[model samples]
Target: MFLPNPDAEFTGSYERCGLTLKEYQELIKLSLDSRTFLVKQSKQSAFAKLDLYGFKDEMVFLSGSSDNIELLHEIMADYGEDVNQWYQPFTSRIRHIRAMKSQSQYHTQTQTDVFEIA
Candidate 1:
């Protein structure tokens, strides 16, 4: 998830993730291609849902249930590269989102004061 600032010089590799510039570009291209396929399939399948939060700054954000996320990983794996290397950072973000959702549900279920007394 780390990227050099727009004003920073290109060092030829991303130090945080150990990906070369070429590899990063390839990862983005593959992700976009796979997203297109997944969107089409999600539209056709009643049980699957995918939401794309378009790229902002240096990241592309996608939101989906665990099943849909797994489907994306499967498709990415089919592209013949080790998906773990390419997707490690994103998987952690997904886990964060899941935790947030669960916390939200817990708060909603344990509601106490609906109004404040003056």
Candidate 2:
């Protein structure tokens, strides 16, 4: 699910399929620490509020990051399972993700609200 992070300045998370919250958070941290998003800026930082979810018989990853939110959203929007589809943009800038319940034609708000509004 798309959980709000109270610790970090910006909220983000990327959970792996079939893993617990702690495990997925660790993996996301590892990926972020090692993965560089902006070469001009400091090396990639970590994501926040990592969690897990499932669709049908298989599990899917859910995560958020200021640098990678759009990427994550695009990935889920295009390739993620429909039942498990979910995304919540923190703002017009940063995006958040969880599990989606609906797939109808809808317009997203510019707020950090992390729920679907049709």
Candidate 3:
């Protein structure tokens, strides 16, 4: 049996928690939209800076989850005007502090010439 309240949070009563199912759905949608909008803006900002960095032999670094790195790679390739951009920075940032300790100096020197923190 499936009871659909459309506004039911978990059971029939969202009021128990001082909320309604519709409100919960709205909140979730808002959060997702916020995240999506931010990502879009970030990418746009990154792309805008692409011309400043140039797409020559300059090496770029990225640090993030494999999925994010992959997506970033795609973004840089298609919209960043450069396909050789390396995702090493994104991967390196995820490394443990101790692991990055030694590589930090050398990595920073060899990694991105111009990049944004966001």
Candidate 4:
């Protein structure tokens, strides 16, 4: 699971989902060349998050710049399979996703030399 407060509330709609910086760049290049590009965002947001990162792809929630049509289409991978959901903050936690066997309510050390006792 993506850690560092994985509990952050997020929408499950891929319509307004995020795209990695690289993906955005690629989208721009394609647009400049007048080409259409598609992204793998059909899966539910929750599952897609896992799938995207699981496949070693980075995500970037670029809805903040949706005002610009170029930016919106750049990051939008799909039209969404369902009604739009509330916008979710791009909390930015791409470094915590990993392959593990099980998960539970637990905490990890903040530092190897020193630990936060709270």
Candidate 5:
């Protein structure tokens, strides 16, 4: 049994609350699309940037948002198949776990990039 989030239109910036779910979803999709392009353009594994700080700014920014937090939780509940891209709002270690598990095959080296906030 599951209950969805309240469906109110959010007028504040992401720092305050959230935009409408549709708008937030669109922004997330755009971020994911850009992430895909980055992976391809850099010739790196999807998890490669996690080992480095390539998208660190974006990740940090997303992590700071109340809207991103709620949106990610909503997404995880309603559409888990799209979970990998939701890692932007998580810590690096959590991001690594989700990224690895998202793939059909796991790589050992991906474990070396566990970034704890301490």
Candidate 6:
């Protein structure tokens, strides 16, 4: 699961990921400060293109393995109740994405080819 800064200037025009800039920064700081393996901060840059309308110079990204719900829970525990407000929406999006992926996979058809040798 990946979360971007909601308060980021460019984020307003696009889908919000439910995290404030302060919260996003703090999360990254926490991981760095503690040198924990559960979470890591990544910096991403988006280039302007005709197809992409919203582009940010530098974006903060935080992610944990899809199977690792504990990573998110641990962060929430550290941040206390304040994080609960945005947690639901964030997790909801993740669940929705997962559902979509599973549905697509179920509906997709696969083809195999065989060759005969003389």
User: Whose lDDT is greatest here?
Assistant: 1
- Cα deviation at 73, candidate 6, in Å, is 16
Candidate 2 lowest-lDDT run of ten: 95-104
Write down the RMSD of all candidates, one decimal each: 16.8, 18.5, 18.6, 21.0, 21.5, 17.9
lDDT of 3 by residue, 4-67 (tens): 2333354555435444444445433433223221112221311111222443222323224465
Better of 3 and 6 by lDDT: 6
Q: Rate the local accuracy (lDDT) of all candidates.
A: 0.47, 0.36, 0.41, 0.32, 0.43, 0.44
Question: Tens digit of lDDT per residue, candidate 4, span 1-118?
Answer: 1222223333442214564434434434432233244344444122111123343322334333333334334324344323242112112122222222112223333324667899
* lDDT, candidate 5, 1-118, per-residue tens: 0112234223564214423445434334443323322122222222222233576546645465675566557656654645465454345545665577777354653556758897
The candidate scoring highest on TM-score is 1
- What's the CA error at residue 55 for candidate 6, in Å? 34
lDDT of 2 by residue, 1-118 (tens): 2222334222232322233455344443443334322111133334343233333212322333354555556656665745345333222123122223122212333335668889
The TM-score that candidate 4 achieves is: 0.19
lDDT tens string, model 1, 1-100?
A: 3222334323544434355555444344443324322111221311122335554312323335577567457756655456656465555555676689
Clashes of 1: 0
**Predicted candidate 3, C-alpha RMSD:** 18.6
> Ranking by TM-score, best first?
1, 6, 5, 3, 4, 2
lDDT (0-100) at residue 24 of candidate 5? 38
User: Could you tell me which residue pairs clash in candidate 5?
Assistant: none
Error of 2 at 109 (Å): 43
Model 5, position 55: C-alpha lDDT score: 61
Model 6, position 16, has a per-residue lDDT of: 64
